[model samples]
Target chain A: MANDLVVAPMLVVLASIVAMLALRPRPRAQRVASVAGSLAYAVAVGAVAWLIVLSPDAPGAATYQLGGWAAPFGITFVVDALSAFMLTIAAVVGLAAVVFSVVFVDRANQGVFYHLLFHCLLLGVTGAFLTGDLFNLFVWFEVMLMASYVLVAFYGGPQHTAAGFRYLVLNVVGSVLLLLAVGGLYATTGTLNMADMSRRLADPAAYGIDPAPVVGLGALAFATFSLKAGLVPFQFWVPGAYRSAPLPVAATLAGVTKKVGMYAIVRVYFTVFAGATVGISVPGAAGASPLAFLAPALLVMGSASILVGGLGAIACDTLDEMLAYSSIGQVGFIAVPVAIAAAAPPGSLRRLGLVAALVYALHHALAKSLLFFATAAIRSATGTHRLSDLGGLASRAPVLAGCFFVGSLSLVGIPPLTGFFGKFLVFEAAARQFTASSGLAGGAVIAVVLVGAVLTILYTTRAWTRSFWGRRTPAVEGATVRRSQVAVLVGLAALIVCLGIGFDPVFEFATAAAEAALDREGYVELVGPAGGDGA
Target chain B: MKTTARIVVPIILVLAISLLLQGHNLPGGGFIAGVLTTVAFALIYVAQGLDYLDSGVLGQEVESGAGVFEHRSVTAFRQTFMVGLAVAVASGFAALLFDEPFLTQTFVIVEHLPLYHELEFASALAFDVGVYMVVVGVLLTILSVVGAE
Candidate 1:
């Protein structure tokens, strides 16, 4: 029973996909099963969280080897504090997005394998989070991307196809790079399992490994990850893809899948590569670890993303486009602290930076998904997501508008909202880094955060006022929002508030996740890969 | 083309089956064998017309003015995909029934069996078969849909 719990989330989603397909002839039953399955997935994630990390007497981390094979020979599935935290974020947003999808997507479209693809996305995310093997991570990434590619082009219109095609082409290139990097790492480190690689990388002399090629390969892999996360220079696909997908699916794309990139960064770089004592030499960076080399690159990408995404959002004409661009900026907010953690001296400050990133990721997931669901609600009622066509929505549908209000305020980092805490921790991390370093780079990072915050407020307020506060436009007059969609928004809005109000436990959870991200020896011990003898 | 397909498809089918059967300890597995089988069908479709499988092979009337979704072969392929998924997942769950971990496999060997004198059945074969079905279903669906377009 204990061993079974480890793979419960993956199994539940697989069963859900199969069950939905089995009932494809009956749309009503299939929809019901989709919802029920999403709920079950959330429950399974919660159970894994409790048993593996949160509960007393919890082991803090556990690994399950598939097919009764021993690690690092077998594919290992790990449930640790970091993955559990990320999974919790995915479950919350995924459930809301799936529920919202049933109501927002047309009945005809829902019958066209919508539920199945959604579960496939969840399964991919779950597998990516839980897999302790490098090659398995790439496989899961492909699974996630495949589902998303179809979902982005779900409408099959010219514009949708165009956006989806661009997305597909870019990601195919990214996947090729990732595959090359993985193969290169395997050759260099002599292992594909993450734990085994980490063990070997920590002591290259014993394993007859050379860690030099890893720097270039790691950069190759990071480019793919950054593309997935929608960081700058690789974020060209963000707005179009988000605008083309079904609004609810866009929410999942923004709130969950983007974070998979962030989670991978933390897991692979910090947990797997941080222990490698490689002398990294970049132009302006100098350190004895790969994290040092990544710090400058991540910081630059993150800061640019903040500026570009914010400016793009400010100029967007539609609500969904604005949110899409905002997602890029929000991910930057998540990435900056991770960069800080990477550059820190691997102590309290490093842990603090990771905690801040995790907290911000959770906040972004809830708040962004809430806002996307609200946008869907507006479109469902008014048949337009154009800011110009929407007005006096707050007076027309007070509840829906209030939910939107909460989401926007959270985005703006107003007090007693989840976004406030997220923003606060991010600034806190950046500020501490600035004080510690007291250098030009540190000061510039803080400045970027400050400007980014102000830009966030500007765009979010523009959206709120333009859509929700002005005189009643033709689209807004007599528009009746769906109660079910509004209910989902309200639930997420309330969750954002609740998480902020009762932030202590969540903070502790994030701290534990951060610790888990940095605890390389503990991870190596948990998986316990045998030596070359394969005993 | 039709004559060539008629001659080559059977050989390809035989080779595919042999590969799948010997996949447990050898180079060929469900994925490769399934792709080979799909290639055979593709040859048949290319040599003959798309409707040949319905009108010529299955002896069913090919309905005019019907979309690919309404085609009988396409529906069968979809069902195959779903059933293949269920079978794969169920095979993994089968280990749980034996109090082992998910996807754990075991084998049974029978001595002095009939004319062969020995027989071996590995549980992993079930999973490989499931994969074979899935690959066939997915590829044929894509082929038919895209080919029709």
Candidate 2:
């Protein structure tokens, strides 16, 4: 009976998503429906999220048996504090995205792009949060990624179509690896339900299974997710997709797609693996051997991502392209806390790490979305996206400049802004690194992350100072900015500020969420403690 | 050309859906099926005028989000079916089901004589059928669209 509330929002989003196929209307009417449906779903999801967080559920184990199914058997929908925290942010961000999409979609293109795909995207993302099954998560990924493919190439011009092709290839490769990992997990565990896997894997000593299979699966899973996270070698598609996508699509990709990977990291590492922070012996571990190699590797890779992504951003000349590079860097920033958590054991850092990751994700989603929209407006008025052709726009568009400034400030982690706290927490966690040899390693990684932050400031400042602050140039290709467009940027900027001021509340919420994740049983209980998170 | 796009759009979509639903049990699951459908949609829009396709659409895009694709799909569904290859696979279970006991097999009979070769049931055949659909539908759709281009 209690499950009704938790599953309602998810069902609502899914219903709306499916309903997209049936709603036939005139071309203009279809456009309106697409936009309106996205907004409605976003709002409805948000309302449900708010209610869930306010409910006085106990800290022990909160669960929801969706569709009257029992856990560890039937599919489940969970809403622990951690999931709730993620859901709330995703919902709000989703709403903002729809608002941007209303005006951004090309009229010549698919009318149902907003109507069906947007709802589908919401369904994928919201489903990602609520489901309790590992395979179910993959299902959500498919929904999210498939829709992304269309939106990324919505304009279907030569440039975007080309970019979409690259994106498609990379995504397929990742999905393959993910499938392999799923296969391996099932082979060893004999069950795909996450809770059962978590419980069974927790005491591998008693399960009597070889450790090589799990490690192998984890490695493959890492490869798949790392690609999605745009880590080191797997990052080729990140720039192209984000760069070529229409402004709103870029915003969603930078803000949404990457988060799915990060979310998976937490889902697998902490909940399923319970902060293994080390390797399993069944793969055959000796005394004080390479058990902890996984954690260190994550740290190193995360550090590398920050460096590469920062350099990439600094080198880009187009505003949108630069944002794409910056997204790579931001993803690294989010991954840092997880890497640190892996390298370090349970301590003060874990809680702060969770907070840092969540806060950074939330702030970046808002800031990045705002920045991308601003870039769109800039392109509309300027007729070009190249940085070299753009300068001295303060006179023509101060509001955009202002939006860019606020978003930049928060994103670059300025004081009292929403972005500042996440970095602050991550840094605090990094500062407390343990292990004699890893002390220096952890220390170096932290230094690299900080430098990445500075690079973020440098590039974004360059963008702002040039695009918005410079003197107005004579008539260029793009001219006459729209107030309707400017309104979108302003609205997002306001959100960044409001969230910034309310950081304390946000921090508290994230901490509780972190506690839930660190303790896997709590999350397992939410969706049914036994069932999966899929349809 | 207009008639071609209109007729092909729904056909491709139907083909794509068929490919997708059968994919888990046979060969052509989400991606290929989705792609086939979308390719068809894309083609129709291209063959017919956007206006022609637009006029026939019964409602606004998908009822929920009022999305751009369904609207465009209405017009371009034939041509656009080239791209809607993505399937809403629940998380990652299409493959996971195979990981269960007995290797997710079904009994099937094939090419038999009078005694016992006439027919049989097989689960692996179901899975293979799924794989076949995904590959054929998706590959055919992509090739056709790219060929048209």
Each model's TM-score?
0.99, 0.77
Q: Write the per-residue lDDT of candidate 2 for residues A319-354, one digit (tens) a residue.
A: 988988888888888888887665455666766677
For residue A138, give model 2's deviation from the true position in Å. 1.4
- Cα deviation at B115, candidate 2, in Å, is 31
Q: TM-score of B chain for each model?
A: 0.97, 0.39
User: What is the docking quality class of candidate 1?
Assistant: high
lDDT of 1 by residue, A409-478 (tens): 9998998998998999999999999999999999999999999999999999999899989799988996
Error of 1 at A429 (Å): 0.8
Considering every candidate listed, which one attains the maximal lDDT? 1
Residue A277, candidate 2: C-alpha displacement in angstroms? 9.7
Candidate 1 second chain TM: 0.97
Measured over the true interface residues after superposition, the C-alpha RMSD of each candidate is 0.7, 10.7
Model 2 alpha-carbon miss at residue A432, Å: 2.2
DockQ of 1: 0.87
* Model 1 misplaced stretches (Cα beyond 4 Å): A533-535
DockQ of prediction 2: 0.05
